[model samples]
Target chain A: MKVSFFPGCSLEGTAREYGESIEAVCKSLDIELQELSDWSCCGASSAHSTNEFLSVALPARNLSIAERKGQDLVTPCAACFSRFKAAEKALTCESKVDVGIPFQGKINILHMLEFLCREEFSEDIEKKIKRPLKNLKAVSYYGCLLVRPPRVTDTEHWEDPQALDILISRLGGESVFWPYKTECCGGSLVLTRVDIIHRLNGRLLDMAREAEADCIVTACPLCQANLDTRQEEIGDKEGVSYDIPIFYFTELMGLAFGNKGVRKWLGRHLVDPRPLLESKGLI
Target chain B: MELIGDKNFRDVVVDAVGEEIFTCYQCYKCSAGCPVSFAMDMLPHQVIRSVLFNQKERVLSSRTIWVCAACETCTTRCPNEIEIAKVMDVLRQIQQESGKQAKEPKVPIFHKAFLDSIKKTGRVHELTMIRNYTQKSGELREKLKTGEWKNDVRLGMKMFLRGKLKVMPPKCGGVKEVKKIFEQAKEHKKA
Candidate 1:
């Protein structure tokens, strides 16, 4: 299957591993990824709040590019998926629709989680798992966007999305179904206000740690950066040791793919996923 | 600090954003946990409480709106699901409409630059976003204030040299559609 990929800003910089892992996993699954040519930032946390039209237009431009390519747009970043999906909803709202884009009715905006959850790929993902993620108790963190602001991702219940858990189970890992799965990881506050993130991320990490889960897995680059990079600081502020590892869903998928350059992408993690992957013999 | 004795304030707030405020029983959970509470004269819960009491000027001008990262911890943790994050957004709108003397705050300035990047180019080219944000913010006006300015200059020079970051944004095919969206947003604000 071929799809247009939208790697938002973070993936190009701090989260380059995510983009690398996507390519590695896609190659293993025989899925062709065509990045939207001349794509712009999805405006992430900024655009929607300051200038709503700017946010919609930013993602719409990419959507139109994908429409021109005549292929569904796929994004590995949950934040990008949410931004694009929000734009798609805003543009299609009957009250105020954009007559210019030529969006027939609905534009196909698929999240990587949604794309991987397809029935055909489920078994393929399962078949590709060379290393067993067995006994690796995991807590799948959905972090707001992939499910929230429900108008866009109507496929599942916004409050309790089981997509990530289902995918984890398919890969031979045990997923702990916790209430905080759909909560916010304090989006983008890691840089602007690191203190609040200390409490916000502190709670989630503490919850995951309490659940006896080995590591937290997420699909958003910002979430990964927050949960992974800020552990030491959060630990310092919160006065507790939270050395928990945060894994990108694609990095785990890379292990399942066992494809070339898989370990290297996962290796770039600040919290070092190597120890966890090695214990499972996946690395 | 005293709760105003007016139902009109309560009614307007509830009407704008349904019963999310009453659930907040002054637990101070919002403030104690807020990362930006230190910067805010009014804590998260205090801001919501002010709005509940119709203390418009206090809530609108407080640093909370500008400082809030919109992390949603208070919203998620609020036994009320008051969505304090959404409330902050409403305060922003109210402030915008009231012409409450508030600029986009320091953090929000970066956010504006990012939004402007999308407004100009269909996509965000980081190099451009950084340059635009720094210049528009006048961060370069006093290089001494920012220790990172030297690093930014070096990175800018290196990125330009390697061509990793583009000098010009790649043209998106749907510039017309993008402009239409921008125009529509302005119309919505006017309406």
Candidate 2:
């Protein structure tokens, strides 16, 4: 299967490993990922907060780029996916704000999880798992963007999304039932108000730890960064230890599929995930 | 509570978000579902209430709008189906247009830095973004006063070593188009 890809900004910077692992996984599955030509930033959290027209125009620009490629667009970042979908909805409904470009929304946009969860990819994904993660117990963290504001995102289960959990189970890992799966990770607030992210992420990590999950698996880069980097500080503030390692869902897939470069991507995590993988004998 | 009905202010917000602000009945479900409500000066429902009551200054100047993560929890949980996050977005725009700086100055600084990065290179260069944000926010002075600047420097260095922080900005072929989008959006805002 072939699709146009939009890496967004984070995929090039802090979330480079997510980009690598996603590409590696797609290659293994024999999927063709043609990056959208000249794609720009999607104006995620900040654009909408600052200006509504800029928010819609930014993503509309990228969507117009993808429309030229004539393929369904897929993005690994949940924030980028939400922005693209929201922009499409906005531009379709409202006519006043001219984007100054051709953005008629000709193509479909999907998040990596949504793409992978598709029926055609499901069998291929299952067939590619060489090393089933036998002893790993993962709490699939959907965070906020992947499934919220249901009308815009059209996510199957916004309140309690199960797509990540289903994927985890298919990879031969136990999906722990946790209430905080769809919780907010305080994205972008990490820059403005670390205190808010510290508190919000603290609650999320605490809930996952309470569920006795081995590690947290997520599809969003901000969620992984927040849960992984600030965990120690949150642990200190709450007078408890939260050493749970957070993994990109793609990283876990790379490991399960026994991809040779999975370790390279795993090494990029702020909180090393190798120890947990080693203890579980999944490495 | 001073009940000042500024319907003009309410209409601006409604028109900006393209949603009826009066539809909100203030069930507080949005406040209940908000993850960062604890840090907000005004709750999510109260933000809508302020808008409904046409308390323009109270709604726009509150730290609540700036602190919102745009997580959409409130938007998702609202029984009235008001996109409260979109309402918050419009409120932030109103705040910026009225020349009222964000109560949490760091929020606006970061947003400006991020958009500036995009405007220049069509993508956000993290190093450039951080440098621009810290400079704009006067965070360096604040950190130095607390003697935490060195630690902040160390974190940046650590990220650099990990190959997570890129020093060079990346440009795309659509830079011209991106600039045009920004210009068009600004024109729309003016209209």
On DockQ, the candidate that comes out on top is 2
Interface RMSD values for all candidates: 4.6, 0.9
lDDT of 1 by residue, A1-283 (tens): 8888887766666677777888888888899998787676776777655554555666777777788888889898877887787677767766544635555434488888888788888778878888767778899998877776564556457667888888788877899867788767767554445566767788899889888899998988878878877776677676877778888887777876667786667566666777876777666
The TM-score leader among the candidates is 2
**Alpha-carbon error at A174 in model 2, in Å?**
0.4
Q: List the residue pairs that clash in candidate 2.
A: none
How well is each residue in B19-107 modelled by candidate 2, as lDDT tens digits? Answer: 65577877888888888888889999888888877787787789999988899988888777787898998888767766667798899
Candidate 1's displacement at residue A104, Å, is 3.0
lDDT of each candidate versus the true structure:
0.71, 0.85
Q: CAPRI verdict on model 2? A: medium
- Kindly list the per-residue Cα lDDT of model 2 for residues A14-58, writing each as its tens digit: 888889999999999999999999899999888888887789889
Give the per-residue lDDT digits (tens) of candidate 1, residues B52-105: 677876776676787676655566557667777767766665455454456445
- Quote the positional error of residue B170 for candidate 1 in Å: 7.5
Q: Share of real interface contacts recovered by each model?
A: 0.32, 0.78
- Clashing residue pairs found in predicted model 1: A40-B123, A40-B124, A41-B124, A196-B35
